[model samples]
Target: MELLELPLDEHLEAVEKAIGEWTEQQKRRCKSAQRTSSVEVAKSEEELRELQKQKLELLEAIKQAEVAREQQKRRIAANENETRDLQAEIMKAEPIITSLKSRENLHQGNLGNLNQESNKSAQAHAQVVDELMKGISLYQKLGLLIDKKRENNLAFIFTQLDPNNPNREFSFSLRIEDNPDVFLVENCVPEVSDVNELLDQLNKTGNISTFVRAMRLRFKNLV
Candidate 1:
């Protein structure tokens, strides 16, 4: 009986040892699986954080786009108001501008008429001057010389008194005045006492050539 009991005890011990080794192996496999699960969880958490950051940035961009769109709408409204005001002002000014243009056209027509009258007067004056110059040329050969000055307002008369002394001259100046229209004699080389009487006759008759001839005859008698 003792020998049979000893063999049974040895078999039991072997079974117990086998059971302990299997339990240790199962514990090691469980710990390894837990470690792998922790690594997967950490990777998933990091990915989730990155996705949340990207979502916040996208939301901020959308908000900024909305603000810019509102500002653009306000600017467009302001430009439209300014455009309408300018158009209204232009409409108000149209009649005044038309009246000013009409007045300008009327003034231009009056100026044209005045210019035509002025040209006709100048032509008539030129013809009169041409005839006077021709008469003066004829008188010059008869020992009478006339010099006009001060826009024809002053006249210088030179007369040869003595036929033998052709170089001897009796010279006098006559100035014309507009108020009452009188001829004033000035700077007579040989003073004549009857010059005022002769000037009165010339002014009354408005005959300058006849007075010059008579004055030359008087100077010749004195010589």
Candidate 2:
């Protein structure tokens, strides 16, 4: 309320204090800006280093690619030589293949001929065996029929009868009972009186034995 005048020195001193305070404030703002600039510079340096590393890697990869290309070219050259050698071998084998084919054809023809001959021989042999067995069987029946004739053939058949028989000590035979080649034999003992009668019955049943045996003996003598 009293308009009392202040001293000029005091007023000047207050102005100087205000100026110092403003200067301090500006210094703080400058320090903050400087810190922000330093951070930006560090980030830029890190980015540049990363880019340089990437560039070196790219250079190394390019060098490896060139080396791989050279290796591929060498492999191709070697394969070309191998292909040439294989082609030559194929050409040389042409004559051998032709000769082998001819030999195979000859072998096939020989095998076919051999198979035909073998089949014919086998059929002939089988026919001969059947005929021989049939002839032998017919003779056997005729001879047995003569047993009742008191012939020596009856004695021979008796001797040939099973010597190892366990259930029977004797065997009986009736020849020419039905067919000329058929004989009916049983395990039995015969009466000596029945022998002559049995031979008579055989002669009547198989009337062909005497003539057949005579002819067989004659034929065998000629052979």
TM-score of each: 0.53, 0.51
In model 1, which runs have C-alpha deviations exceeding 4 angstroms?
1-46, 142-223
Give Cα distance to truth, residue 109, candidate 1, Å. Answer: 1.2
Question: How well is each residue in 25-135 modelled by candidate 2, as lDDT tens digits?
Answer: 989989988999899999999999999999999999999999999999999998999899999999999999999999999999999998887677556545533443454
> Clashing residue pairs, candidate 1?
none
- Provide the RMSD of all predictions against the true structure, rounded to 1 decimal: 7.6, 14.3
- Per-residue CA lDDT of model 1 for 55-142, tens digit only, reads 9999999999999999999999999999999999999999999999999999999999978876765564454345556656776776
Which residue pairs collide, candidate 2?
A: 148-199, 149-199
What lDDT does the true structure give each of the candidates? 0.75, 0.55
CA lDDT of 63 in candidate 1?
A: 96
Model 2 local distance difference test score:
0.55
